[model samples]
Target: MIVWSVLIALAGAFCMALGSALQERDAVRAPGHSVARVGFLVHLARRPRWVIGTAGAGAGVALHLVALSGAPLTIIQPIGVTGLLFAIVLSALFNRTRVRAGQIAAGTAVMAGLSGLLLLFPHSAEVPQLSIGTGLGLTGAILALGCAVFAAAHWVRPGPRVLLLATVGGAALGTTSALARVVAANAAADWTAVFTWLTPMCLAAAVLGGLFQQNAYRTGHFAAAYATLLVVDPVVGAGIGALLLGEGLPTTPLNQVLAVGAALLALGGTVVLALARNRNPEALRAVADRDEPTATKPGNASPGARASTTTTSGESR
Candidate 1:
């Protein structure tokens, strides 16, 4: 049962990753807020592709829910990081995105380290729980901090927006995942856990993280955003679970070494993603060009096929 649950959670994470990838493609050509929303609506309305992506995400979530029911939060969260690897492969195949061998190697290191570290956490029969007051206070603080950082990042030149959104989204996803781990563990707890401040905060973080990544996809390279988010989310979640939740470590020194190694694996993967992004700046544009949009102006062959036109009264237009 525990294994099954883990599989489900992983499936959900995988779906979510794919969805993020698809949304990011759409964001590239969207230009502005209104355009982006309209683009999304149009994409979803007519394209069967988005539906497929959504279905994958839904399946992954369902699996995750079952997995959480059986395993410790600490254990499950690290394993969930596999979705990053899956996303890399899927994006490469479906989106025609470029990836470097170094990125893949680095990501492997990080995941390996994380897996080792997670093994150190003590499994408890007790499920996780959320406290309304604590959750609200913590969530409010994090959101405020993230928003401040986001604004500051936007204030700077353009390139960093990808990094900024990646950072914020990582934090948001980390918080939400950490909270979710707690909630999953506390499934057997009382009803009060359901109404706690963590509930709303988790929901909000999930939404914000989705939006942040969406925006990241629009204005920046996918590898950059995906790599940063992938690397940071599990790391942050594990760190919080260890420090705040009193999760422990492996007793043996060798295991500790393995844990560090796993962390390096995850980091390596992230580097691979980053380098890939740098090497192929136009990767995002390529994906965007392929994804069909919902609404087309009359007499258009496709969004990418439009040729520049001039009226008789040309005025530098």
Candidate 2:
């Protein structure tokens, strides 16, 4: 079961990577003011590419549910850290750029560190328990945190804004993972378990996460946004698993120290990726502009206008 879960989760990671790449391709062209708002999702929903990308993401979620049904949350959740690697490659391909060595090394570090930290936790078969009070409290806390981050993103520059949005997205999705584990476990026993409070909470969290994810993509910093998301998702999920699901980590001093080291490695990798610049920013900008309306296309603009737009875009990134 564990082996099968791993394989399924791997496939899910690829789908998620594909989804993120496709979504980011269109998201970067969205009106910047609309991001982090409901109007943003409404606009993307009209675009066929974004719709297809949403489908891919939905498929990935379904596959993740299947994987969660078979394996402990700690073991299964960390598998998603691999999606950062796939996302890096896919983003490069979409942007018509080559993947840099630094990106590869940093992505590897994030995967390794997050994977190590998660795998160090002791797995358990115990069923997850979530009382109504605890569930409500957790849900409220996540929502509050997301709102706070969203508000803060507005005052920051694009790079820091992307990271803040991704952080909230990851936290919400991590909460979703914990809730889904309980839902999956219950559904396995009684299919009617799908009609529960936790199910709605899970869906709400997923939606919140998805919104922030799109906002991050809109910032046009794929590596930083994606690396942050991938790192935070598993870290938050593992915390929820250990605290709420009874999947505790090693109690040994050596193991605890190693886990902290792994976490620091992941943090360092995320910072490196965030600082890494795109190799061909102009090319990427051109490709993204292709999705804009004909009236807004660079070809339609005067030389001075085009130059101004370019400067603005550069500063925003």
Candidate 3:
């Protein structure tokens, strides 16, 4: 069962990577004014590629849940770090670009650090539990933090904005994972668990996470955004698992030191990946040209002028 869980989790990671690549391709074409808003998702829903990408991500989540049923979060969550590597390859393929050596090295660092940190978490067989009050508090805190980060992203440049959005997205998804554990445990003991506050909160967090992810993609930095999200998700999930589900870390001093070092390594790797360039400039230019306004009204300009403007815009990125 454990071996099967590992295989399933790996497959889920690939699906997630494919979904992110497809979604990012369309997200970059969304109107700038619509980003980070409800309308942004609504707009994306109209695009076939985006819808297909969403389906892929949803399928990945389903497979993750199945894997979780057979293995502890400690094992299952670390497997998700492999998604970053898959995402890099998929993004390069979509853009018709080569994956640079620096990107490969940085991505390997991220996966290694994150996997080490997750593996260090001590798994518990204790069934997860969450009271209504605790569930409400968790939901409120996650929503508040997500909103604050979303607002902050507006003040930053495109690069920083992607980081900020991805952070919130990752946190929300982590919370979703933690809550799902509670709900799944309870439901196994009692079917009425579906009516618990945790069920709704888990769904809400998943939706919130998805929204922030799309916003991150809108910045057109797939490597930075995806890398940050993957790194943050497992860290946040492991922390929540420890705090809320009794899956604490090892108490040994050596393990503690190693855990801290692993965390720092993961963070450092995330920063390096963020600084690395992965997408092709021509792909970005194509997206810009496609999104350029077609109207001849004031500020819209003719096709030639719009082409020139799109070229400049792509260059600025």
lDDT of 3 by residue, 193-265 (tens): 8887788899999889988988877776788789888877767887888887778866899999988888788
Query: Candidate 2, residue 94: CA error in Å?
Result: 1.2
Error of 3 at 207 (Å): 1.5
In candidate 2, stretches whose alpha carbon ends up further than 4 angstroms from where it belongs are 1-10, 32-34, 61-80, 279-313
Over the full model, what C-alpha lDDT does candidate 1 score relative to the true structure? 0.60
lDDT of 2 by residue, 46-108 (tens): 999999998997888788879999997877777877888898998888877889999999999
The candidate maximizing TM-score is 3
TM-score of each: 0.67, 0.82, 0.84
Question: How far does residue 311 in candidate 2 sit from its true spot (Å)?
Answer: 2.8
lDDT of 1 at 112: 67
Give the alpha carbon lDDT tens digit for every residue of 159-269 in model 1.
456667776778888889888778766654565655656777898888767666665665545665776776677667766676666664555788777766766665555
